[model samples]
Target: MKAKPSLRPEDAGDRPPFGRSWGVLYVGVLLNLALLVVLFSLFSKAFR
Candidate 1:
Protein backbone atom coordinates (compact mmCIF):
# COMPACT_ATOMS: atom_id res chain seq x y z
CA MET A 1 0.00 0.00 0.00
CA LYS A 2 1.14 3.53 -0.73
CA ALA A 3 1.53 5.94 2.15
CA LYS A 4 -0.55 9.08 2.13
CA PRO A 5 0.74 12.57 2.75
CA SER A 6 -0.49 14.14 5.96
CA LEU A 7 -0.58 17.68 7.34
CA ARG A 8 1.04 16.53 10.61
CA PRO A 9 4.38 15.97 8.99
CA GLU A 10 4.18 19.40 7.38
CA ASP A 11 3.55 20.95 10.79
CA ALA A 12 7.08 20.18 11.95
CA GLY A 13 8.11 23.77 11.28
CA ASP A 14 5.35 25.16 13.48
CA ARG A 15 5.86 24.93 17.24
CA PRO A 16 3.08 24.88 19.85
CA PRO A 17 3.05 27.67 22.44
CA PHE A 18 3.49 25.41 25.47
CA GLY A 19 4.05 21.83 24.49
CA ARG A 20 6.22 19.36 22.59
CA SER A 21 3.58 18.79 19.92
CA TRP A 22 0.41 20.28 18.38
CA GLY A 23 -1.77 17.46 19.75
CA VAL A 24 -0.78 18.20 23.33
CA LEU A 25 -1.58 21.85 22.85
CA TYR A 26 -4.97 20.98 21.35
CA VAL A 27 -5.85 18.67 24.26
CA GLY A 28 -4.88 21.30 26.79
CA VAL A 29 -7.07 23.88 25.06
CA LEU A 30 -10.02 21.46 24.97
CA LEU A 31 -9.63 20.60 28.65
CA ASN A 32 -9.49 24.25 29.57
CA LEU A 33 -12.69 24.90 27.61
CA ALA A 34 -14.45 22.02 29.35
CA LEU A 35 -13.46 23.34 32.75
CA LEU A 36 -14.76 26.76 31.86
CA VAL A 37 -18.08 25.31 30.72
CA VAL A 38 -18.46 23.40 34.00
CA LEU A 39 -17.68 26.48 36.04
CA PHE A 40 -20.17 28.58 34.12
CA SER A 41 -22.90 25.95 34.56
CA LEU A 42 -22.33 25.90 38.29
CA PHE A 43 -22.36 29.66 38.47
CA SER A 44 -25.65 29.85 36.59
CA LYS A 45 -27.23 27.23 38.81
CA ALA A 46 -26.09 28.97 41.95
CA PHE A 47 -27.77 32.22 40.89
CA ARG A 48 -31.04 30.47 39.93
Candidate 2:
Protein backbone atom coordinates (compact mmCIF):
# COMPACT_ATOMS: atom_id res chain seq x y z
CA MET A 1 0.00 0.00 0.00
CA LYS A 2 1.17 3.54 -0.79
CA ALA A 3 1.25 6.12 2.01
CA LYS A 4 -0.35 9.56 1.46
CA PRO A 5 1.89 12.61 1.72
CA SER A 6 1.67 14.50 5.01
CA LEU A 7 0.09 17.95 4.93
CA ARG A 8 1.84 20.98 6.41
CA PRO A 9 0.56 24.38 7.60
CA GLU A 10 2.70 26.15 4.97
CA ASP A 11 1.13 24.07 2.21
CA ALA A 12 -1.99 26.22 2.29
CA GLY A 13 -1.91 29.53 0.44
CA ASP A 14 -2.07 32.88 2.19
CA ARG A 15 -5.60 33.68 1.07
CA PRO A 16 -8.58 31.33 1.50
CA PRO A 17 -10.94 30.45 -1.35
CA PHE A 18 -13.90 32.41 0.10
CA GLY A 19 -11.60 35.02 1.65
CA ARG A 20 -12.79 37.49 4.35
CA SER A 21 -13.91 41.11 4.34
CA TRP A 22 -16.12 43.08 6.75
CA GLY A 23 -17.01 46.21 4.74
CA VAL A 24 -19.36 44.60 2.24
CA LEU A 25 -21.06 42.46 4.86
CA TYR A 26 -21.73 45.51 7.01
CA VAL A 27 -23.27 47.40 4.09
CA GLY A 28 -25.48 44.42 3.19
CA VAL A 29 -26.79 44.16 6.74
CA LEU A 30 -27.54 47.87 6.89
CA LEU A 31 -29.40 47.75 3.58
CA ASN A 32 -31.47 44.78 4.73
CA LEU A 33 -32.42 46.58 7.95
CA ALA A 34 -33.48 49.67 5.99
CA LEU A 35 -35.64 47.59 3.63
CA LEU A 36 -37.27 45.81 6.55
CA VAL A 37 -38.07 49.09 8.26
CA VAL A 38 -39.59 50.51 5.09
CA LEU A 39 -41.71 47.39 4.54
CA PHE A 40 -42.98 47.38 8.11
CA SER A 41 -43.86 51.06 7.92
CA LEU A 42 -45.81 50.58 4.70
CA PHE A 43 -47.74 47.62 6.11
CA SER A 44 -48.60 49.44 9.33
CA LYS A 45 -49.77 52.51 7.44
CA ALA A 46 -51.92 50.44 5.12
CA PHE A 47 -53.63 48.56 7.98
CA ARG A 48 -54.18 51.59 10.18
Please name the candidate that would achieve the greatest TM-score relative to the true structure. 1
How accurate locally is residue 24 in candidate 2, as Cα lDDT from 0 to 100?
A: 63
> Where is model 2 more than 4 Å wrong at Cα?
1-20
Question: What are the Cα lDDT values of the candidates?
Answer: 0.86, 0.74
Cα-based lDDT at residue 45, candidate 1: 100
For every model shown, what is its TM-score relative to the native structure?
0.62, 0.56
Model 1 lDDT per residue over 1-48, tens place: 998776675465787656888888899899999999999999999999
Clashing pairs in 2: none
RMSD of each: 4.2, 7.5
